[model samples]
Target chain A: MIGATRHYEIDIDKVDHMSKQLTEEEKSQIYDDIKEFLSEELDVPADQITPQSKIIDDLNGDSMIYLELVEMFKKRFDVNVEVRLIGQYFQRHPIYTVGETAQAVYDIVERGDNLLADEDKASV
Target chain B: MDQGIELVELSALTAPGVEIALIDIERHPHLEDAADQFLEPDERARFVTLRSPHRRREWLAARVCAKLLAARKGLIAGPHEARIAQDRSGRPALVDPAGRAVTGITDCSLSHKGRFACACLGRPPIARVGIDIETVSPRLRSLRDAFVNPSDAMEFHVDTDADLALLWSLKEAYSKAIGAGLHIGLKNITSNRNPATNSLRVRTLAGRVAHARHVVYSNCVVAVCFIAQ
Candidate 1:
């Protein structure tokens, strides 16, 4: 397990701006990218992944796989993010669906700044 | 289902000097306090570094179970007299109160899932031992392609989710017994189920063969592997 101490501030204004800049096509592409990555990593068929698919329960991903998925997302999205930060976000928000995870990744790309700042709010 | 720690004698599988113990940690809330008494100073220090209470409890439960199994095999007089420590490769090794490796003990493997933890101990002539416990669920089915070989699928006729879980558990036990862990691909370990005998034949990538047997207790499945020299 890797550990780091830093703050990640979710800038609502930046997120709003990025969300506004994001087109429907781009959002759909991002979702497709996530599904494709999961399909390869989990060795599951692409048809199995849906908006409602749960990463752990539906895809059989453990905590270690969750971290690996975070790493893959970082590489795919070209975002500089920490594993602990994503872990903290998931811990606080409890992402249950594939759509929710994709949305979280979008937020991380647009607004994730020192996510560990809110350590007191959630345990990861 | 009975909740306490139950010792199931593998009388048919047991060699000259071997013992197996299965502990249901959920049933032993009292063991949490008792765990501290059994842990060595270094073990207690390591326990404090765990961030999650769930992880801490699981670690304590595994240690307590390992120590109890050690005591039962006469490796130590009591749980407090033996300590389970991991080597550089994260493989567990038993140490005496004086911090010496226990003689005659070959290898021990411990595994836990959900509320269950199982430990298998082997002495001389019994080169390796591995045991794993897993809850049967649909989640395991999703990992079939990643872990199960096509030959294993055909030989075992793994059609259901429970069957996949059983295969995964058997591979995990075999890997642990071989001390390769996941470094050895799950697919590299092939398995064939003997329907008549209700046993599994596991062959590793190195061409070593071992026999495994599983027992279902409650919603969890326990698999044990023994490799004799």
Candidate 2:
């Protein structure tokens, strides 16, 4: 039944990170993490995943899935994401590519940690 | 005296020579929505600005107390002038506004249900008062862990006919009496039915605050906390 769902592949290169840049290797790792999460949560094969997959429509993920994803991301990346803002971001600037969504998330974490590090250095 | 309401006969804690009146809406002019024209300019603005019925009840209760005082030719002109201030937890109190000594601690607590709103006013004899009436529902039985203190859980004993709703109400009233609200945490306070006094023993952070509990209507439970000044 899972195989019957239309398989979509996520193209990692399409996303424009602008000045907030993430290396290709870092971006690839994000895809690996998100792919593992989606496979386990949806009970679908890894090859069936796509970046353009609508979380609710294509992946059949609910609020609980989003919450689980949020927890998984926080635990894995050590970044704080407001649960309320997650739904809004997914609806507009979607992760149409596998690594793009996770890459976006990684860049955010990297920037936040760097800012905190700068503050600590300044204080010292 | 509301047709839907069964007016459980409640005794008011009136002071010596001070007048107190308990008028049911059915007996009065259905003054639930009635505005006090005698309000001061500031009071009028404040009262008008209030949007919620629950908030309006607090203001109306104070106004009603002021009117009752004025009728008796008391010292205070209006309820707002009756030295009303909020406790730390934001529970309202009628305190001495000026540094000068208050005539006596005239405190009042308002409770309303459906269409009937009741205000309990008293002097120093009745120090701190807190009352709560909760509508009994099947929901209380399922969600018992949320409100019930672990110690009180066994006492609740959800049998074929357990009144967990009333138990919850008594617990709430006890907390309100301390002016702590729910922030003090319900688990900190213990509630036990004292067979001797026929009142619930509500243990607080400091000591046990005596409670007078009553179950009214099959749908509701009422508990009042009595603290000595």
Error of 1 at A50 (Å): 26
**Backbone clashes, each candidate:** 5, 1
TM-score of 1: 0.64
Per-residue lDDT tens digits of candidate 2, residues B33-135?
A: 4554334454566666554444455445445644444334455544445443454444655444352423654554545443334444446666666666555
Best of the candidates, lDDT: 1
Estimate, for each residue in A1-124, the C-alpha lDDT of model 2 and write its tens digit.
1112222233335433232345677567666667777787566677777775544434544323443444454444445543323433443344434445565466454543342334447769
Fraction of true contacts reproduced, model 1?
Answer: 0.00
Write down the lDDT of every candidate, Cα atoms only: 0.67, 0.50
Model 1 lDDT per residue over B1-229, tens place = 1124454444544556456776666677676666567689989888776543555666677777777777666677776677888875567877887877777678878777667667778787778877777778776554565567888868765778677777878888887788764436676788877788877789865768887877777877777777788
Q: Model 2: clashing residue pairs?
A: A51-A96
